[model samples]
Target: MSAKESGRNVVAGIGVRGWLRFIWRQLTSMSVALMLLMLLAIAAIPGSVIPQKMSNPQGYARYIEANPDRVAWMEKLQLFDVYTSVWFSAVYILLFVSLIGCILPRIRVHYRALRNPPPRAPKNLLRLPAHAQASGVTRDDEEMRRRAVGWLRRSKRYRVICDDEPGGALVVRAERGYARETGNLIFHIALVGLLVSVAIGQLYHYRGQVILVQGRGFANAQVDYDSFSAGSAFDPASMCPFRMTLDQFDAKFRVSDAQAQDFTAHVTIDDNATSSKEQIKVNHPLIIGGAKIYLQGNGYAPEVEVKDADGEVAFAGAVPFIAQDNVYTSLGTIKVPDVTSGDQIGLVGYLLPSAEQSESGAWKSVYPDLLDPVLVLTVWRGDLGLDNGIPQNVYELDTDNMTQVAKDGKVVTLVVRPGETVDLPDDLGSFTFNGVKRYVALDLRHDPSLTMVLIASIAAVIGLAMSLFIPRRRMWVRIAGAVASVGGLAKTEDENLQREVRSLAEYIAAPDKAPPVGPGQAIQEGKAE
Candidate 1:
């Protein structure tokens, strides 16, 4: 045939319908489903290794800052958002569809098999894998058939059916272990449920973090959190109407090595007119109103009162300091933007919990406890960047347009202890170190699909156990004038099938006292004809 004619004939043979059928068959096959499942797992690896924007924004920012050139390419590939990426979603959707397609047909077939009866006994039973025969039985054919059928049903729990042969013989066909297929189907169905639950959770869950100083209150609102991330479908109005106050916070550290021993945050929660006091600790979360509040971290917030040159208080609140070392050496920023004196004043400083002057004349914290707390600060005068309409980090002070306070052509530093006040240079202001209060960083998470996920996980485990341990097998028993035959077949390789058949044959021969025989052994010396 000519090349063009051959191509035309091939196209005619396999049209659009044939091509679609072939694709559907391949996509719905068990092998394809398993491969897709594996591919989904592989796709999740990038989400773990790379910093995800939704889960770890700080880490993602750091990664972008460190690898500025790669950020564009990585974002284009959706590496930072692996779970929500188009490729990952496509794999997930394909796996879901494949599992459903593969399971539905198997379920239909299994259902039909459940409604149908066991197959008829074969003509030659000796050809089976496990077979046994007995001759010279004293019982009548009717009694033998009755006893065999009754024993198979009552003792072995097999679904049995008996029929009369044409030549005064009886045949009993029995089968059991339909639960194997049932469990297999249940396992696949549970997998689909788990996938759906996870998808819902990824679409509607919300998580946020907040830092609360002692004696401060916080409400459950999107605007209250310092950092918040939520699924695309999450709504701010759905948040529970709850309020919490940090009444107190406590921390303990080892004396010798300054290792942190424990941390606890005491808080009062008010939800919908109900009020309760609770203590939150690491790993132990407070669950309320379908949300869980976890104590993520703890630090110290130094209470300070900043006054302008006119002695009017400009800033009076606790400023949280990020801990820099195990000894509680912390860094903080205090911005006095509303000062009515000179230019806007900013104070950048470190808090040393247990102050100790080093050999180099630098102050550092020798211990985590408040042995000799001191604030070491540097004053600045500038615009404070408040009127620029640009959002800034509360813990960071922008010093680009600021001039450091100088004394005799050298930058001046101020050291203030608790209850002590230090004056600023150039008559900017004065700041008093009142005291220190403990603070706690809390993370609240709400996932409405958690219950469904937990239930589906448990069901999947049970179904898998059932499918693995259960055995499917069939047994047949035939009785003639004074002889009987028994045979068994296992869906899989079961070593006990021969023993069961032999036991059945022996029981038919002698109901009260059956002969003991090894597995796969015939009761009689000659094979049945």
Candidate 2:
């Protein structure tokens, strides 16, 4: 179709024509394209300032918590999560619409340009910026004109026109870099395509987080997780068959007089599936059953022995303890239900990986490994707050509903070194330190769409590059005759010299040449003469 009709159809189909029509038109306008390019750069600021959803969520929550009122307002404004904000989506959609609108019209115009040669070279050649004349060349005007046209076709990139009048004249034109517009459009369209691809990922992809304590073998289920959030079209079945067992954990740290470095942990995971049996570390993740299993951290596991008033060992095993300061030192609890013990009773203790007697007579860890591990006991008899419905830290000792009976003061102390047992003097009974076991904190994740998203991202990038760097250009050619004034100039070197000395080529060839060029050229050239 014709370019004019095609452009009209596009506008009509979109149902817009008014002052706002400029908005729609300008949105698709080249001006709007430049604006979108700038807008994308400006829009990226919020993602960096605020904590993105991809990063630590708790830290971002803390930021919101710090300013409840402001964050609430920001949420309303979608500023906190700008990438997923409705306003951001609107900007993206508008930019895309503008892209299509602009490209279609340009495509139509380009098609038209390709089909039509430039309007017959301007009627007045002397009126143009580039015009030159010479007189007194070959006597045959056609031959001189033909020679000039050949020169234009060879070096001037022009479809030439010549006059049959006396000394003959030629017209030449050339154009280059016209394909730059096509390149610009491709770049814009590629940007729109990339946005669409990113939106598809944002709407269709899913990711979740799960925190597993030591000795915990979590199944890939909806429950028993710290948090979970899914994409709009995410499906639970897309989750991989994730089953992780924290088989064994080992941590080693540098023990030096100065700085401590070279922190390392080794963990063994078995899933009974493909790539199941593997050893993982902090930087290395084990691929188990099509999921990534990382040993996020490691902590102490104190060997605890529990006994009742009946002199029977009710519980005896290594209880997971969280590290507090350094050197694998951890805080853990040994809870004994009041119903089972017939009284509210619990023991909270701090265990150290390597304990040393400071010069001030305080306990501290000299190293992280269990070289001479020790656990200083602080006795507490209380009702454990399990049924209180209040969340408690697994690495803390809750001293509610009870008190410390005896004050050991500076003299009170008991350090159960590794392989040693401490005996209680009262009927509270005694426990032995058998051995210790280290446990790893594994973060097991499964996202079936991760690879697909990556693939789409790569494709989008390549498409974008192809569209940006490549340009499409074209040339249009029109040819006709030169004017009489040009044709009549200087058929001989004699006339050329005579023209320089005031000759009369224009008076002779003004009637039978390429339009007014013959007249305009003669008038201009004679003045110069």
Candidate 3:
């Protein structure tokens, strides 16, 4: 092809290589990286606002039930598993890729610049952003160049070089702020390291929760946990063998306003051969076997007893109730699938600590402390739904196949206090309330990459500070025989550059003599302007 035709084709359209270069340049631009970062942050918001099924199945289930109309869409979008959702993952992955693309080229450019010397001095020093002149100098060009080089080197802040032009003019070129670009590169590199650490942590971490009543113990086993979540790569066999026993649970409330003050769970831990006791409270976790045990919640578990119509003890134990409010109003269900001498029975009840009657004549808890506790029970008798073998929530009662126990066509409301007994309708059973014991909800978590994340975070902060404080600058001093000229240029417009040029001019020209007229007055005039 003719050279003119080739040039015409190139101008008409970009080839495949040119198109690829254009796309890459756009992706690696700082503006594109910033937009990706903002999009990633917005994508993470739903993870915090919505209840995640991986962490809290009960809460997620309640959310789904509460928003029945939106359940299908939420499930399809994986709103209940926001962190692992496809849309969130795509955004996170894109953000990391954009950052990497943006930083790699910058790193290469910075490395080359660090290896190269400061740029050559411009010929017209008078036209520079900052300039100062010293005329009628006693020393020659060689001495003036030597003194300027010596002074800059003595400052110990600049990379100094002296050179001579073809016309015998001496020049000294100095640069002091390479650290500004170095810090910028370090900050970006640390961000990449942090993202890698977080990805690794997410792949290997595990978290599980259990409710422990006072005096009860639990082993660190998958089957023992009420709910558990683990990374895709987590191995069950790698879990440390540990056991924890809840010795006591103490909760304090503000006497003035009845608000919760503090909660502490005293626990003894056995990690293989080692054993120790620790107080686990909110924000204070117990570390054992490379795992952390955090106190998440506290509530009352009422001790109850039930006897069949034949007067034989059927069920007797502590039933944990889910707390409904800060005042310790709790809801629970007790199912007696095998009564031995009577029909299967289910009891739904509410327990109130520090009970009192509201203005509307309804029962409510006045405080969180154990003062005048009351239990209101509603009895139901029929199939307990255990024969079908479907899993059911222990905290909820399935009353579809059950009939309420009533007298004179009205459902009986049995209100009994601690240490009191209430007989059931039709003499089916007898219920006894035997005070309450405290229980704690414990979250156990293990993440191997937490230390790496911390280190990267600290490095990022240091790099950011250095990048913000340091400024890139260059200075040049040129001497021709008896005349010396000083010039400076800064990457940013800064008053310090003018001051530095003025100061260097004053040093070159003897201070004992009268001040240099035009340049000194011009600097002062510029400053005033």
Candidate 4:
């Protein structure tokens, strides 16, 4: 329409380059960077509260099954994989860019400031915040200036420059504490290093979990782990070749409340280069083969023997029972697919350590120790669904196509103790409860960037301390025909600035009476003039 209207439209539009510049400035601001860091911490809360797919597959599956209506929405939002989610990655990348953008310009400015000298002294020293003047100086102007410069250089350890004013007065300007800004820059640089180290650790780390029954051996292979997860850059071949056998597991519980007190897993580890015996406790881990083995949990695995009706041993082994209660009430499953006749059988039941009969004629455990252990089970005859080529959880039994063994039109519950045998209904089979053994769940983790992360963390702490405690300051001394004046200025709110200026003025007035220089009295010296 009109030139003015077109110009107004153009100004309002803020063309592509202008908009880009504005966005970059906002993103690189320190306030925005801090906000993003806080947001990242908040976003990690979900990963800790909810079961992550990579870290806890079985728990994730159970959650999905328990909350079917919410599963679809949760998965759609990538809540099940929070750390690797698209939104999380976007935030992480933006924070990285913001920190780098905030650091580069500061580094350049600091470099230039380091090369240049401190600002010249002001005309009138008495106008400064911290100022002192000594009128009765016996020394000449040149002698006073030289003494002041020497005291600032040797005793106070400041960078000194001597200049003659146009009015024939001698000025000694001194400055110190460039290290304050250097420490600040170092802290920010170390922060960036820490972020990069963490990202690298995430990309190259691997973790696996396995349950080891007593006397059973395990190898460091992908197939040996019950559950395993690794970063995108991790390779299976990079795993350290190590083998270990569970010797024994010891657990102690308090007698009064049956609360567990201690747990230890004794193991023998054999790496390709060496072998050793080690004990892994709850907080103490075994470090070998570039991996850390942690004892995560402990439970009982009851040994059992199963025989078909034809008197043939069908199955036998120690079955791990997950503890469900404080007194060691555990649940487990046993499947017999090699039965000689009829159909497959599944024994689903609980093991009660220190078993006792309740008032209602129910079996329960009273203590965590194995004083009177018993097995209470129910027999089911059916297809175990193992031959269907689908993976199944060993801890669970699917009875959808199975029928419970019954006697006289009533369900039969088998009650057996260690070293006892019982007959099954309908002449199907015989089940025996053979003693119990302990098992331990172990988690192994390998991270290549741990050293770098540790060093960066330490450096960050040191730099932060320096930036907070060290003070940047400048001092000026002017001597003209027996009148000597001193002034001090600090970049930060320094409480001792006035005291320091007064002390310097007194020293300049009578250098012979000043205290001798000592190591404790020395401040950090800056570049020489």
Models 1 onward score TM values of 0.84, 0.58, 0.85, 0.85
For candidate 2, give the lDDT.
Answer: 0.55
Which ranges of candidate 3 are over 4 A from the true structure?
1-22, 42-53, 56-91, 136-147, 154-156, 310-314, 324-326, 340-344, 356-364, 382-393, 510-529
lDDT of 2 by residue, 1-529 (tens): 8868777643445444565786777787878877985786688688788875444465565576567778767778777677778777777777778778887887788677556553334444333322334333323556434444444356434434332223233333333233444555555555556666666666655444554434556666546455555556666776655565555554444546423344343333433454344567667776654667666666677777766656667567777777776666687776655334544445666787777888897888766777777877755555666787554554565676765535544322456876776654334555567667776565656555466556655655655565444332211111234332221212112223323212223332334445423423443343223
| lDDT of each residue in 433-507, candidate 3, tens digit only | 998999999999999988989988998888898788887889898888678888888887676888787777766
User: Deviation in angstroms for 152 in model 4?
Assistant: 3.2
Instruction: Report the number of the highest-TM-score candidate.
Output: 4
RMSD of 4: 5.4
User: Residue-wise lDDT of candidate 4 within 439-460, one digit each (tens)?
Assistant: 9999999998899999998989
Pairs that collide in candidate 4 are: none
Backbone collision count in every prediction?
0, 23, 0, 0
**Candidate 1: lDDT over CA atoms?**
0.89
lDDT of 4: 0.87
Q: Model 1 Cα RMSD, Å?
A: 4.4
Task: Using TM-score as the measure, name the better of candidate 1 and candidate 4.
Answer: 4
CA lDDT, every model vs. true structure: 0.89, 0.55, 0.83, 0.87
lDDT of 1 by residue, 1-529 (tens): 8868777643447879999999989999999999999999999999999999988776787688779999999999999999899999999999999999999999999999999999999998888888889877766888888888888999989999999889878999999999988988988999999999999999999998999999999999999999998987898999999999999988989988999999989999998999999999999999987999999988889999999989899999999999999998999999999988678889999999999998998999999988899999999998888787555678888898999989999888999999998887898778899999989999999999999999988888888987888889999988886778888888988777887887788877774555444433337522223
Best first by TM-score, ranked: 4, 3, 1, 2
Worst 10 residues of 2 by lDDT: 484-493
Clashing pairs in model 3? none
